[model samples]
Target chain A: MVFQSWSYVGFLLITILVVRLTSASWRWLPLLLASLFFYSLTHWGAFVILLFSIFYTYFTAIRVSGSAHMSIRYRWLLLSIIGQVLILGVFKYLGFFNGVMQGVYALLHKGDWNDWPLLVLPLGISFFTFQSMGYVFDVYYKIRKPEMHLGKYALFVSFFPQIQSGPIGRSKEMMPQWTSISLPSFEQYRWAIQLFVWGLLKKFVVADRLGNYVDEAYDTVGSMGTWVWLFILVLYTVQLYADFSAYSDMAIASARMLGIHIPENFAFPYKANNITDFWRRWHLSLSGWLRDYIYTPLLFSKKKWKKWAVVYAIGITFVICGIWHGASMTFVWFGVVQAMILICEMFTKDRRLVWAEQWGRTYQWASVVLTFWVISFCFILFRADDMYQVAGVLADMGQWNSSLLTTYLAEKNISRLMGILFLLTMFLWGDERWDRWIKQPQMSMNKSVLAISLMLTVLMVLGVFGKNDFIYFQF
Target chain B: MSNEELTARVYGVFRKVFKNEGISVHRETTAKDIAGWDSITHLDIISGMEEEFDVEITGFEVMNMSNVGDLYDLLTQKLAE
Candidate 1:
């Protein structure tokens, strides 16, 4: 069931009520069952697959522990990673890979292999697969031991709130939270409710509203002007943040209702002065996971590099990360551009500001203008249908060199510029001070309760009334 | 270098790389064993060791060196030659 579903909401309400009514283990038992029921609503068959994955890895880990030699241990570790990736590839990327291979084969006159049945994309397969694999890999590396208990392990993988979209909680982070059988405190409830409300505002009011313009511009297929495509792409940066962060905000808040404290998933991503800062802020859990598992391993594995080599690894990892999102050329180029910009920054150090300073006031302001435009230009790839569309969009953007500023987009779309401004300001403002604002301590229980109640009321009116799914669900 | 000298130098590298001067060093300590040590900070430590000692490290050794003692042994063997 969707977090936004009426049945789910009703179930959750009953859950909150029952938790308040009971104590200790008795309280969480029904909640755990309810969580399973929530997961089963999506695809019961796939849920069985999920259960099998959990069981497979759990047993595989225990079995691997029985092995004697380091080579045996390494074999088991390799098998575990290979099994999980193969499962992910079949469920998530078989179609993706097939599509690519067909095109490549057709070009070579080997003909397309079109006989295979389309693979059904499993919901939350990416998330749960990663979680299970992380368990085995960590055990193999001896970073952490496998949990002897099955129930807590199951709860870790299928924690319904996180099973869908994740802050990609590590075994180290979430395992401790699962150990508890406690009640949600009043403060936790208040903060959870506040986070839920803010998340709703982001998803429904902001994201759904922005989706209207983006959909309109991009839906026309190949006829869309180059400038218009670029416009939608920049707006996507806004859409993506709203979609994913909203999911994370809700996930964290929902976990909080169960007396589980989850980590914060987003920082102020757009306000990032550099791509490095962007990684620091954006989809933090996934980024952190990639760093620990992917980037660091690759970086340290390579021999020591000259100054340029450090920058090269930074560029390479970002590009690889970008391609992992999709096989599209747009994604590839966008990733490379972002990495290149970041590499450029590594060489500049404080010299960037120094150059601006030496160039005086007009040049400094011009630099800021240049910086913002360049970043926006890179975002064009993320928004386009393909690289061909990106070319068309970039070409259209160039044509506006002599046109009036007011003609940047259609008349109706022009109204949405206010939203763009709002998004930009909020993002820039969020970086330095939004966390400080939200974390401001409330004075009393009653005041916190009242504030949360009012915020939930607003969310009920604005957020829950819509039919939109959380944007990060697809990713 | 003796194990004790190697241990102290590796500990110094750890403390400096992680930027926590007050960290107590021990042979059994992993990255998580130390308070406030994280992946990014650990990379800083590895990077610092490479530059300071002028010795190259394999990715295999980096991954396997979970504790202070593991690093100390690896450094001692490399520095010996």
Candidate 2:
């Protein structure tokens, strides 16, 4: 269940009560069971896939790390990675590959190819498998010890809050927490509740409302004017950020309430002035994981490539990242665009810095706006159904008119849309103020209560409490 | 090599690679301690250390090194080996 649902609310409350009532030593049992229960709510078969992966990685890691023979350890490591990738491939990318093969056969004038029903992609398969692969690598490299306890490792793999959409936990970061359970502190409870409520506000009031316009605009059959496409594009970008970051905040806050600290996923990515900096601030855990596991190793693999190694590594890593998003050509092109821009940024760093120094704050703000628009342009590919839709949207760029304005104004919920925009502005302003003020002193209880009550009121009235499937869940 | 020699060589490497002469690394000095000391420059530093010391640094060693002190200790140990 999504964090916004009443079912999740009930589950979380019960979980908190159970954990608080239990002894510290036995706390993990309930938590683990609860996690499995939550995960299996999607499909019992998905639970089985998760279990097999957990056991496979746990055993493989222990063997890889504990092996006496160097060659044998290397073999185990390779096998584990291959197995995990194969599993992800079978479940997620089989349809894409099948379609490619069929197209190839048609082009070659071969006989008609038989179509097979694609396998159902288990929820969180991509996330958990990637996480497990990272763990096996960590163990093989001796960066972290393989967990001896199977149960703890299982918990690390299937932690319910982060299972659906993740800040993708590393074994080194999360294994120790699962090794032992601790009662939630009062401070933890208070912080988690506040963050959870804030996440709900972002998701329901801001993201979902923006998503309504985005979905409507994107689902239109024909092309739109340039202004309409760009407006809807910006709305999708904002909606995605709000939705994904909202999921992260709730996941982290939920984990925090259980005395586990998951990593923060976003850090004001729109503020980034360049593609390189944008990746650093967006989905930080996945970026860091890829840097450590994929990019760095590729960069360091060959001495002859020298300076060009980083360029090659970045291209490869981002390509993999795009494919990891989905089995779609649009996603592939999205990764290619990002990598190309980053490589350009790398090459022009000296000139860019010189320009920055010459132009000062105006240049910096200009760069930020430019980066946002460029990213929003790329996000059209991300939001499209296929390449045809992408072309349709791009082909209609010339028809600039006031129809978009007239049409949006004609919608019945125009006032609600305006209200959302106002709330968004207030949220952004208040967040900046709070960031600066939070370090000075804690808020008084009365002020805190009044602020939270106001937030709750807004949540009750303005919140779009509709179907709350998080956007990232599709990946 | 003596620790003094190693430190001087490392200091030179940092200065040349990062192009910042003001950087000074000690036991507690980490990536956070020095401006422009990111993963890209981190690779340069690793290459520099390996070339200057005439010693290979393994991936394991690279991953485990937390600060200048750890690097120093690792270099000393690798050199002894």
Candidate 3:
């Protein structure tokens, strides 16, 4: 069930009630059943594949942890990674690979070959595989102990709140909480509700509204002027952040209600001064996973290369990051561009710090603005469906006309647009402060009530209650 | 070298790698406690320590070293060897 729906709300309430009523030791049983039931709602195929992943990784990790010989452990780790990657590759990339083969066949003048049937991508397969693989890595590295309990390990992978989209939880943080499941205190409930309401406002009011404009612009890409395309690019970047971060907030809130803390995914990424900083803040769980599991090992293995080792690692890691999002060349290019930017930032770190000190706050502000624009432009590649669309959008940037901007502005809902702009400004201004306030151990009841009530009122009055599934759901 | 002397030498490597003169690390100090000691600078610190102490640190050793104390322990073991 989608997190925003009334059915999900009811499901969550029932699940929480069940958990609250269950004895401490038996709590995980009901929670695991609920999570599986929740996931089964998507597709039985997805359900079966998820089970395969859980079982495979569970056994592999145990094998890795059980082995005494370092070579045996290393071999098991490779086997586990291959299993996860093969699952991801066949399900996610088969179509893209098939299409590539078709192109090659056409080039060779080969007559129509039989097409292979594509399997439905299990929802959150990308997330869970990475998470499970990370668990295996942790076991191999001895960063944390291997979880021997099959039921608890499955719950860690399929926990309903974060199963679809995640802050991508770690076992060390989540496993203990599951074993010690307890009902959230009243303050915790209040905080979860507040976070949920804020996420709703971000999704329905801000993201969906901006999405309307972005979708419209993409729908008529050929006719849009350069200025309009640029505006739409910026809007898409904001919409993505709002949409994805909204899902993360809701997920974290849902998990928090069960007293399971997931990682924070986004940290005001737009305020970042460079691409490297942006990655650190945006999708923090995934980036942290990559840094710790992928980039660090790769760099250290080639540490003899010194600085070039970092460059090599960054390039490979981000290319994988791009492919991790989907099976498209545009996604690959998106990763390549980010890797390029980060490499530049790495090489210029000392110089940039010197510049920051020389120019102080002005340099910081300018860097933030510049980074936002760079991210916005790069997101054009991300937002487009394929390379052709990316080319069209980039080509459109060459045709500049001011009158088209006025026409574009005139055609849209000006009042709604103004409202979105105002809300966006207020959100940017108060986001960190609001986050800090809600996270405090003790908040004044009166202030909490007032804040939540105001947010609910805004959401009800302004939210576009259309069937806009979260953008990241596609990934 | 004594543990104190080794820790002092490691702290010196951290300071030089991060370019911060006032930096000090203790047993409990971690990457979170330092501003620039991320995955990237982490390698720099490792390399600097290797140079300063004339020892080789394996990737496994680096991964296991979660804090300054861990590093100090690894260094002492390496130096003794």
- State how far residue A389 of model 2 sits from its true place (Å): 0.9
By DockQ, the better pick of 1 and 3 is 3
Candidate 1 per-residue lDDT over residues A1-475, each given as its tens digit: 7765567667777777776676765554666676677777878777787888888888877766657777888788778778878877776666667777888888999966774565666677777887787777667666777888877777778887888878777887787666555776676677777777667666776577667667676555444455555566666667777778878888888877877778988876765555565677878887877776666666665535545455656667777667656546677788788778777776775586577578887765565456545666776677677877776665655554423334545565665687566765675456346444444545366766665676566556644245557655664
Q: Order of candidates by TM-score, top first?
A: 3, 2, 1
Interface RMSD list for the candidates: 3.5, 1.9, 1.1
Model 2 pairs in collision: none
How displaced is residue A270 in candidate 2, in Å?
1.0
Q: lDDT of model 2 at residue A53?
A: 95
Pick the winner on TM-score between candidates 1 and 3. Answer: 3
Off by over 4 Å in 2: A221-223, A402-441
Q: What is the TM-score of chain B in candidate 1?
A: 0.81
- What local lDDT score does residue A226 receive in model 1, on the 0 to 100 scale? 52
Instruction: Indicate the residue-level lDDT of A54 in model 3.
Output: 97
What is the lDDT, from 0 to 100, of the residue A152 in candidate 2? 76
Q: What TM-score do all the candidates reach, one by one?
A: 0.82, 0.95, 0.97
TM-score of predicted structure 1, chain A: 0.85
